[model samples]
Target chain A: MEELLAEVVNVLVVIVEACGAAVIIIGAVWAFARFAWVGFRQRTTAAFVPVRLTLGRFLALGLEFQLASDVLRTAVAPSWEELGQLAAVAAIRTALNYFLSKEIAEERRQVAAEQDHHEVTSTDHRGSGV
Target chain B: MSAVAEVTRLAALGTGLAAVVAGALALVVTRRPLPALAVLLDLLLAAGLLRLAGDPDWQGIVTAAAIVALRHLIGVGLRAGGRAWTGPRPPAASAQEKSAL
Candidate 1:
């Protein structure tokens, strides 16, 4: 029974890790395409902001999957060495994930502020013109 | 090494290459080095994270850590430099002044 359980876990770990890799690949390809299109069409520094935000979102998602796999690895039986390695990897990933999410929030706030400013300025212009 | 690890490494390499291309394109089109640099750093971080998908050894862990550190350093530097590029004339202005020059 123990061997059977370990086998199932090993298979699950592989599947989860593959899913995480796939997410990263898809995200990278999508972001690259958007980057090229936006850079070509808009050609402004501000325009690339959305693309960066999207990429960050994808990366954060992928990291979550990877972190899950890390946890699953230690579920069956974790030696001291394995646990130590897991701790290191998990810490690094957690830190990256936190920073990415924070940056995304900040970027969203900035974009919103800019849009609000634009709307107010346009309103003021129209009001003064009359 | 397992097949999954091999595939993940290859994917990471491809992602890194895509990052370089995207970064160069942004640099060329936007004509702003700072934004381009930020894009490059961000994509490289993605690549680094992707590399950690499989069973990463100590070396792989260290490499990813280094990338995270570098990204943080560069990100702080860019933020300090200001949110936007400060020095150069806007591209539109440069284009208009091209005839005068």
Candidate 2:
């Protein structure tokens, strides 16, 4: 029974790890395609907002899955080496997530500010009959 | 090795699969990534719970939970920033109305 359970656990871990990797790969590819399409359409920094936002979101999610898988892989029987590796991976991913989120927030603010400015200018022009 | 460990691994796999599918849908079909992002964060919390099922390691589970919470906090802050940016616009008035006033 113990052996059977270990086999089951090992299979489950493999499946989860595989799925996590697949998700990351697919998400990265899809995000890249979308970003390229956007870039092709408009070459301006402003035009890249959607691409950055979308890609950042996808990457962030993929990183989280990757992190979760790492945690699971080490949860059952963590050696010192495995624990050390997990710590390093977690730190790197956490840092990436933080910066990506910061950039996304900044872009969102810029977009909102631009839209508001546009609206105000349009309103002024209409009021002036110009 | 143990039943608990097996269960934890199974839960992680299940949640991992769900996160992947939700992420794909957000990227392709719906084009709405925020909710999917939230779902992914939620999955982190679930993964943390599953971790507890195996070996009572506070470090891993706590880290996962902290990440999820931090994400939510950041999201709230960003939304607040957006609102602040858009909050100060004056209402529009017609030329005739402005001249009369």
Candidate 3:
């Protein structure tokens, strides 16, 4: 029975890891496709705002999946080596996620500021009737 | 082979395949040089997972770290490029002379 339980747990771990990889793949593909379409349609410099925002979000999601998979890999009886590796992987992934999120927030603020500037300029132009 | 080990191998293979596909898609999507960095990260993560599955792939982790560093370097270069591209260009000497006249 214990052997059977181990097998079950191993299977679960594999499934979780597979799911995490799938999530990262899907997120990256989706963000890339969206960015491509936007870039093709609008060749303006402003097009980068949406591209950056979308890519940033996808990257954060992918990093989360990678982190989850790392955690799951150690769910079973982890050796000291495995534990050490997990610690390193987890730290790297967490740091990447943190910085990506911070950049995303900064990009969001820039986008908002640009929109506000555009609105004010339009309002001023309209008020002057030119 | 033990069932656990077999499952881990399969999982690693699946992850590698997914990462390759994701990387290809990212590369295809953008003309800018930015997406390549993300693609490299995806590939690195996939390689790292495979290494974790008892594969003798110590170099994968090192390569991933190098790729991350390269991504940072590229990001800095891109930022500089963007600033140069957008910054005001000085008026041509002819235009300046005409204005002066």
- Rank the candidate models, highest lDDT first: 1, 3, 2
Error of 1 at B78 (Å): 1.6
TM-score of chain A of each: 0.93, 0.77, 0.81
lDDT of 2 at B18: 54
Off by over 4 Å in 3: A1-6, B1-56, B76-101
> Rank by TM-score, descending?
1, 3, 2
The TM-score of predicted model 1 comes to 0.88
Q: Report the poorest 10 consecutive residues by lDDT, candidate 3 chain B.
A: B49-58
Best by lDDT: 1
Q: How close is candidate 3 to the true structure, as a TM-score?
A: 0.64
lDDT of 2 by residue, A1-130 (tens): 8666657766676665555545544554454455445445543435445654665576567566656665666545437865765565566567656765786687688779899989999999999995
List, in the given order, the native-contact fraction of each candidate.
0.79, 0.00, 0.00
Residues A1-130, candidate 1, lDDT per residue (tens digit)?
Answer: 9898889988998998888888888888898999999988888989899989988898889888888888888887558877877888999989988988988998899789889989999999999999
Model 2, B28-61: lDDT tens per residue?
A: 5335455445445544433443443333344655
Q: After the best TM-score superposition of candidate 2, give how far the Cα of residue A61 lies from its true spot, in angstroms.
A: 1.1
